[model samples]
Target chain A: MAETRQWRLASRPTGEPTRENFDLVTVDRPEPGPGEVLVKTLYQSVDPYMRGRMRDEESYAEPWDVGDPMQAGIVGEVVQSEADDFDEGDVVTGNLLWAEHAVADADELRPVNPELGPVSTALGVLGMPGITGYFGMLDVADPSPGETVVVSAAAGAVGSVAGQIARLSGARVVGTAGSEEKIDWLTDELGFDAAINYKETDDLEAAVAEACPDGVDAYFDNVGGPITDAVWPLLNVDARVAVCGQISLYNETEVPTGPRKLSKLIESRARVEGFLVGDYQSRWGEALESLSEFIQQDDLHYRENVVDGFENAPDAFLGLFEGENIGKQLVKVAERGE
Target chain B: MAETRQWRLASRPTGEPTRENFDLVTVDRPEPGPGEVLVKTLYQSVDPYMRGRMRDEESYAEPWDVGDPMQAGIVGEVVQSEADDFDEGDVVTGNLLWAEHAVADADELRPVNPELGPVSTALGVLGMPGITGYFGMLDVADPSPGETVVVSAAAGAVGSVAGQIARLSGARVVGTAGSEEKIDWLTDELGFDAAINYKETDDLEAAVAEACPDGVDAYFDNVGGPITDAVWPLLNVDARVAVCGQISLYNETEVPTGPRKLSKLIESRARVEGFLVGDYQSRWGEALESLSEFIQQDDLHYRENVVDGFENAPDAFLGLFEGENIGKQLVKVAERGE
Candidate 1:
């Protein structure tokens, strides 16, 4: 019998998620059923949206029930397979969890080949987050050549990939980040046209105007708050806004006050929209293929903030709110057996 | 020489407009130029947008210069014509002012025949405000047959007409107004599916949900603020928002805050857009013709709040902010000569 640990939802959070909200319990791993594979967990992703799922409230995704195991994107190696597709020693990735081992139907698990890049990349750039950035940026915003595209949280996993893909598509890309170092990475390393350090800037609207002189043609919004309020007025006529996340406002008990200038969107004749990545599931392959080509061409760059040990998973997840993690947040629970 | 009395901009107000913001001055009427006609002003229109014009700040239309005559849509008779398009005793309407008499270029005015409908209809359902509602609701939002459409200020000029047109196009029409009386008028008289009195409702979101059982498919937004915040979450997938005005926040010095949940827009895949009537100038004839046909078929209804004097124009204009006017605000400054 194999050993496994499961992180279960202990309690619903009121504001910021706490350690008390989750519990780790070790148990004997179950044998795989027919047409299923038992995966030995190698890496688990810690995402901001996991905070939303921990709450007993309605969201774009189903909320985690109290006393149920907390779920997230995970990469693992197939140890035992009763499935025709997945074989022993095959690496796989899926929406598994913070578990040492998990059993899922073969159809739900995607085989991960190291030849595609690093195995952890399956849970980061070449996975759901990468596909989200690629498809949402291209399909929702639909930027034209030379059009200015501004993204928020630019150094984060989704925004970084989104900006690079936008640049590859011939857009003039700008971004906003929480720290100066992230700003440097966005502008100097990631090839963003301009990167605004939102923490240092007193006036976000002025910074946006300076970066996008002709006005932003497309806005890939990840952090919706004062930053979005500032960008709303500066959008050109017919500009498209893709609302992927509102990380900054997620923890706030009250909505922030500013210009209430939603009417300005009418004046600019701009379209503000929201989207979920799951809606594009059928077309995800196109995103993966394009993102892979970009990565191979040296056109896209990604950073992984890999935390060691299952106990430190909470730290990595909490680091997202403080902007401590430079890229995708992940936890390596155990070494993979080749 | 003919006697003429003009209402001019006396001063710009800090917040709410006052009687002191306007000056009624009597001036000696001048002769018409080569292509001009001497018009004896009869019916002068007062609209919410005119309040914006009184300020010395820029808006969609240029601000009224300090001490200059206040301009608005006026119905008059051509007392004298120096151009072939107009003759003596012809009824005309154009951007005139709260004056007993004036001189205008023949090219700037449109001839209105009483055979079409009451001349007051021009300012209500057949003029700028009407055509504004027409083009905005039809061309911009494009509410299809059997779709659910909601309009704010349902008993007011633009909104009242917009709802009927939406109904004529086979939409389930819901509306919001300031009072129960107005709400009754919208639902009982105008044939709207439902109406919500925003002032009486504590939970606007719940009220809107009850009124619009199915999510809102199209929104003709004349009032922006809490009403907009309520409507945001109820928007269906592929929902269209035609931002006509933000009457609720127009007088506000700051932006109102609720829940900054714009990210929800992405989850619903809705589009919130802003627009100006002038931007659709090329489609004016089509809208005007269709609106005229609707009125001719008795498929549309409109109301007008006619203030008696040119001297009272400032009061009538300021009343818009207080939600005092029932429908189109117009000033019958002079008796018709025809």
Candidate 2:
């Protein structure tokens, strides 16, 4: 029997998750069943949304039970297959176990096109996060030319792409991030009109006001806390808000409280919609096609912070709350054809 | 010159408005200018939205400055006209001053059809409040058949009509109001599936949850505070919230704070939109036509709480915050030919 290392949920976190909540163990790599492919893991994604799954409550995504094998977006190479669609050494990606090796139904896996860019992008810019930002910005927010758009957590994988998409639509884009490096990446590299280092600013509302002088016509919200509280009052008439993620409030054990905002909506006649990328599943091809063209033409840029070893997956996920990664955070579990 | 009694703002209120905030004075009735008509006030509207205008800050409607004549929806008989569109004794409705008489541009006034129930219906069921509910329910919320729709302040003018519209569309309707009479009016009179007396309920969330076993698919929000906070978590997937009024929070001296709701929106993929009746001006004829048909066919019912004197107009407006009126709150200023 082939041996594999798997990460499992040792326990659920009360507030912020730590390494103690995860357990790593070696187990036999199970044989592929009919229409299943045995994949050797290359890279696995760590995202803010996974924090919700750690809780024992029902959310958009199903909750992760204690002692169950953890699952996430995994980019891997097919080592063996009982499925006709894949063969040895073929790179693919799917939502799979966070392990050195795992078997997935062939129908669930998508063949990675190395021609598009690096295979690692199958878990980053060319994958779920990229599509999430694409549909969230273009469909939900729908910023028009010359309008002002603001994106919170703007240097992260989704925010960076969403902000650039707004800029491409001819809107004046402003972004907010925690660190100066992330701020620089947004304004200097991502073509954002302005970027606010929220950690360094005493008053985020005033900083946002200075950046968005015309008021925010569209807002792509990733972090919902004081940053959103600040943006709520500055919404222009008929403003559109895409509630993409609330990374700021995800870890709080208690229901968080903030300033009442629905009153501001009436004053501005604004529309605030919460959406999941899976809602646009039928049109994901449209997002990928556009994203690919933009990347080909050098209009869209992406970055990754790849942490090595399958044993370090929990730490990479924990780092997301600390704002430790500049872009898509990933764990490089193994080399292809290992 | 003939005299008319007018109400003016005495000063902006720090919290809840009081009788001292209004000054009633007798002034000479003004003559009609070009394209203007001098209207003799019959019924003046005292609504929850008027509270927003009393504040010093700008809102969807321009704020009324101290010493300026308070303005509201007025149904009156045109005593004098300098325009070809209106004739003397023709009842008309417009956003006009709260007084015995006021002059308005003929273009701004709509002719009131006395045959469509009572002329005061121009200020209640057949007018702004009616159209507001029509568009907010059918358009913004867009409740479909078999969906669960929840309405707050459900016995109020806009909410009564909105809930009925949802019921007419074949959705299961639930309402929340302050009094048992209002609850009875909602479930018994307005055809709501369930009604919760929020004032009587100790656990509003549990009450809402119990009423909506399948969860809420649409919400018509008239009063935003604890009622809204309770309903937020009970939203089903893809719920729609039409934010028409936040009467509960209108008089707060400072910005009110409550449990954060955007996270719940993400869980349900719900859409929260704020809308004003004025935005649907072009389609008002469509709304009024449909509403008139519904009324004529005995499918729609309306009620009015007439406070029988103009001297008590401020009291009528103040009573809205206390949830005093059963239906549309109106001040009967004078007889049609007084």
Q: Which stretch of 10 consecutive residues in model 2 chain B shows the poorest summed lDDT?
A: B182-191
Best by TM-score: 2
Q: Can you list the residue pairs that collide in candidate 2?
A: none
Worst ten in a row by lDDT for model 2 chain A? A113-122
Best candidate (score: DockQ): 2
- Name the regions of candidate 2 deviating beyond 4 angstroms: none
Off-target runs (Cα >4 Å) in candidate 1 are A255-258, B144-146, B335-338
Candidate RMSDs in Å, in order, are 2.4, 1.0
What TM-score does each of the candidates earn?
Answer: 0.94, 0.99
**DockQ of all models, two decimals each:** 0.60, 0.86
- Cα lDDT tens digits for candidate 2, B1-338: 89999999999998999999999999999999989999999999998988888988878888998998999999999999999999999999999998999999999999998876799998888899999999999999999999999999889999989989998999999999999898888878778999999999999999999999999999999999999999999888999999999999988988899999898877788999999999999998999899999988878888999998999999999999999998899999999876
User: In candidate 1, which residue pairs get closer than 3 Å at backbone N, Cα or C atoms, i.e. clash?
Assistant: A259-B255, A260-B255, A266-B274, A266-B275, A274-B265, A274-B266, A275-B266
Q: List model 1 lDDT by residue over B99-136, tens digit each.
A: 88889999889899978888887788888888888888
